[model samples]
Target: QVYVNGELIGGCDITLEMFERGELQPLVEAAVKVQEGNQQA
Candidate 1:
């Protein structure tokens, strides 16, 4: 499984699929935005 900042994002299978489709970057960027928002809160 894959965890980002202790939250489970997905398992290896889904992660690999996202990478292959070039969708991982947006997901990562969104996650970063969420983290930044939380920090400002």
Candidate 2:
């Protein structure tokens, strides 16, 4: 799930695209990294 400013903004579930371009991979990874960084702060 994803949210912004305490409001649920949008999200996505497992899909076929993750296996195609591999673009989703980096995005998911980067998003997690940023979220972890935010929580740590």
List the RMSD of every prediction in angstroms.
Answer: 2.3, 4.9
In model 1, which regions exceed 4 Å deviation? 3-9
Best by TM-score: 1
TM-score of every candidate relative to the true structure: 0.65, 0.54
Clashing pairs in 1: none
Put down candidate 2 lDDT per residue, 1-41, tens digits, no spaces. Answer: 55433444345543344436675657667778888999999
lDDT of each: 0.83, 0.59
Lowest-sum lDDT 10-residue window in model 1: 1-10
> Per-residue lDDT tens digits of candidate 1, residues 1-41?
88765667699998899889997778788889989999999
Highest lDDT scorer: 1
